[model samples]
Target chain A: GESVGLHLPTLSVQEGDNSIINCAYSNSASDYFIWYKQESGKGPQFIIDIRSNMDKRQGQRVTVLLNKTVKHLSLQIAATQPGDSAVYFCAENKATDKLIFGTGTRLQVFP
Target chain B: SQTIHQWPATLVQPVGSPLSLECTVEGTSNPNLYWYRQAAGRGLQLLFYSIGIDQISSEVPQNLSASRPQDRQFILSSKKLLLSDSGFYLCAWSPILWGLRINTEAFFGHGTRLTVV
Candidate 1:
């Protein structure tokens, strides 16, 4: 079965540094992708999204990069803060209006 | 400015008990509703999605079921709960394009924590 997956289960970084989370998807038909930030005991919050047409989209301090050729997606966060520590997930939009999610990567920002 | 509301922030039920979790969307009409489950230290699993009233799709087979009674309300239910069903459940809504397609991104609610023992 086609699936979406992340490269790391946990990523540790220092405050004020840039953090990158990577994802790999197997479905070529997916046209849209999203990154979500989930805190403990809360729902996932929308961070950024990118369509297949464009390779990169930037928002605030977050950037989403999509490479259709390699079926890869990434989220880059600048100036990582303590509040930015959360589980990040990459989602692929399937044809049925469903968002297939990856296993998630726990981002730990330490001072 | 659409917001999603899911009830019962936390719940504890015994095995074989009935369950009902409700979600509603405000400030948006004809939005696509979805139910997703996330286990501890895991990613999200899509359980159900609804484009409109009575139009729901289940992604995987399980002891749970979902319904869209109204345009803005989505409900997840189970006749008998299983220990494996314990997890954090989230409700989300997305804009509908031309009443047939869904938008790129989805907004999510706070979520419900279910514990079945």
Candidate 2:
């Protein structure tokens, strides 16, 4: 069975510091990966995504890096702010097939 | 812009009670709909997905069932509820072009908090 998992269950970071969250997936056939942020009592919000073909993709203040060799995915948030505190999840799927989600990593920002 | 709507932000039900959660999408046609359940401090578990009206696929076998009555309407229902059914239920929608699914991210609703007591 294929599974997606996070390396850390909880992460604490000082405000203005860079935050990195790591995820490992077992499905090599999955070609699409996405990262989501979920606040308390809210639905998960899309943060960024990277295809298997690309090694890295950057958004406003976030970057997603994928390493197909190790089946690893990571999300980097620059100058992390207090509002960046939330649970982050990484999901993977084959094209448009069902997306498989990993246990979320809770990012806590301390001022 | 497309938006997903889910109702009953919070629900409290007893054992053996009937349950129904509704979700709908606006501003999109023939979108792919999905129902996901997240337990407290857990990841999202996909329960059901629909590619079109009356077309559905269930990922897990449980006491609950899902139906797409209309193009934009998706419903999760159960004739009798159990304690294990309590969780945060989320409805999501994604774009489907020419019968092919796209890479566009799925948009999730606010989610319904179900507490079966």
Q: lDDT for every model?
A: 0.93, 0.94
Candidate 1, residues A83-110, lDDT tens digits: the string is: 9999999999986778889999999999
Interface RMSD of 2: 1.1
User: Which 10 successive residues of model 2 chain A have the least lDDT summed?
Assistant: A92-101
The TM-scores of all predictions, comma-separated, are: 0.97, 0.97
Worst ten in a row by lDDT for model 2 chain B: B96-105
DockQ of each: 0.77, 0.76
Fraction of real interface contacts that model 1 preserves: 0.74
After superposition, the stretches of candidate 2 with alpha carbons farther than 4 Å from their true spots are: none
> How far in Å is the alpha carbon of A53 misplaced in model 1?
0.7
Q: Which candidate number would show the highest lDDT if scored against the true structure?
A: 2
Candidate 1: stretches off by over 4 Å: B98-102
Docking class of 1: medium
